[model samples]
Target: MLVLILGGITFSHAQTKSDSLAIRQAALDYIESQHQPDSAQMARCLHPRLVKRTFWKYPRQQREYLRESHADEMVLLAASYNIKGDKFPPNPRKEVILLDVSSNTASVKLYADEWIDYMHLVKLNNEWKIVNVLWQFKDANRHQ
Candidate 1:
């Protein structure tokens, strides 16, 4: 019985590690897909119902407004956001920090050159997909 318990623990640890790695990969894919402007790659990691939200203050606007981007819009943006290849720095910031993971859900924080995104992912059909994100520019005055 003790041996069996230990084996179960070992298996659980391995599974957790695997999940963490997959989750990190999904987050990285989201970031790199944008930088690389690979819409297909971006579509692969995002769920069909993905929702990305941000709070933005338009120029000369007194209040902040909520902005949203869906999966289709994101994929389209990815295809053109960096078409010229000069949008980001030579070595732009792309940091993915795994916040938490469970059996089928995970949360991550991705730091990019211009903004930071808090992302939520879900495991579906044995694949991790980004389902939600809340992002903001690092510098409040900078507008996207």
Candidate 2:
């Protein structure tokens, strides 16, 4: 009985780790797909109501919302860089440090470049949706 209990616990932990990995990879893929990547591909990975957060020098919190229709934004992004036929990187190395999930809510810590970033996600129906993100990038060059 004890052995069975231990095995069950281990299985649960493994499943959680797998789920976290999937979410982390999906997030990275979504970000890369924004660089002349397909909208359909983005629609598969990103939440319709994703929110990006940043804090200004005055301590004012700024938020950008990704609504259902992001075609205009995608066009602008492409035009700015003049990347008409650039394909996204095939593989992005995504590292997930932590994931805490409860029912429909999940909190995750992920390593991108400078350090780990935190996000709150919610599972809506059959979809894992990112509801809030807390991250700040110094500059685009810093991301490189």
Candidate 3:
């Protein structure tokens, strides 16, 4: 009986990790998609009402960047990221998912040698979209 109980607990934890991975994967895909030149390419994974709140390395706090419609916001974010895009086009997304997930929300900890990054995601219209990205970017190298 004890063995069975322990197995169940382990299974639950694994399930949580798996779900969190999915949420985090969505966020990563969105970031990579930003590499594309056009906002339309980035729109696939982003929520129409994605609220972009960034954290600067100096003063640690969530600050309002922009909150707008899908098309407008995507353009703004892509431009800010400095994604010159490519002559080709966006291909199938490539990203890694490592995060903690819950029913309505998720927090993804993007691991890197330099600084830490935490992406907060929310379930909107039954789809996972990154609502907030809080990170202390160490260098100019893009986190994606």
Q: Which candidate comes out best when scored by TM-score?
A: 1
* Deviation in Å, model 3, residue 86 alpha carbon: 9.5
Compare the candidates by lDDT and give the number of the best one. 1
**Model 3 lDDT per residue over 1-144, tens place:** 998888777222233555565576676565554555445546655665665544333223433343223435765666555454442234533334555566777777664334445667777676777666555545733322
Candidate 2 Cα deviation (angstroms), residue 126: 1.8
- In candidate 3 the C-alpha lDDT for residue 75 amounts to 56
Instruction: Return the clash pairs for model 3, or none.
Output: none
Q: Which stretches of candidate 1 lie over 4 Å from their true place?
A: 1-15
Scored by Cα lDDT, where does model 3 land? 0.55
Model 3, which residues run further than 4 Å from truth? Answer: 1-21, 55-71, 79-97, 111-116, 139-144
**What lDDT score is found at residue 126 in candidate 3?**
67
Model 3 residue 123 CA deviation in Å = 2.1
Clashing pairs in 2: none
Q: Per-residue lDDT for 15-124 in model 2, tens only?
A: 35556655666565445555544555555555656665544342243333432324344333434432564343444334565467655567777665443457777667
